[model samples]
Target: MEIYQLVFETAIEINPGAVAVGAALGIVVGVPLGAAIAKLVQKRAERGVKGTARVGRLRAKRAWDA
Candidate 1:
């Protein structure tokens, strides 16, 4: 058999129900993984902003005194 025929045959052999179940499982797993990553990134950004603000305040205080 040719490679294209073999590939098509393999695809046909897999059940549609199985494919749907796999897709559902992937969505279930992916949503929380994506949300957790977004939450982590947001936290890091907030922390960076706080640190920058603190440094800016310190600089302003020194400038005011001098």
Candidate 2:
């Protein structure tokens, strides 16, 4: 057998196991980080909306006074 053929056969043998391990690791590492990031974004958005509302209230109160 040629050297290239041997290498190809070895690669084919390894591919499925490599892919399964990689997928398992990705799911293990990805899910919690994704959830934490989502929570942080939600809290920041809520704070931003509250701040906007406060500013709007101040502007309306000032306009009413004027």
User: Against the true structure, whose lDDT is highest?
Assistant: 2
Clashes of 1: 0
lDDT of 1: 0.81
Candidate 1, poorest ten consecutive residues by summed lDDT: 7-16
TM-score of each predicted structure versus truth = 0.48, 0.48
Q: What is the C-alpha lDDT profile of model 2 across 40-66, one tens digit per residue?
A: 879978777657678789999999999
Query: Model 1 misses residue 36 by how many Å?
Result: 0.6
Please give the distance, in angstroms, between residue 26's alpha carbon in candidate 1 and its true position after superposition.
1.0
Report every candidate's CA lDDT: 0.81, 0.82
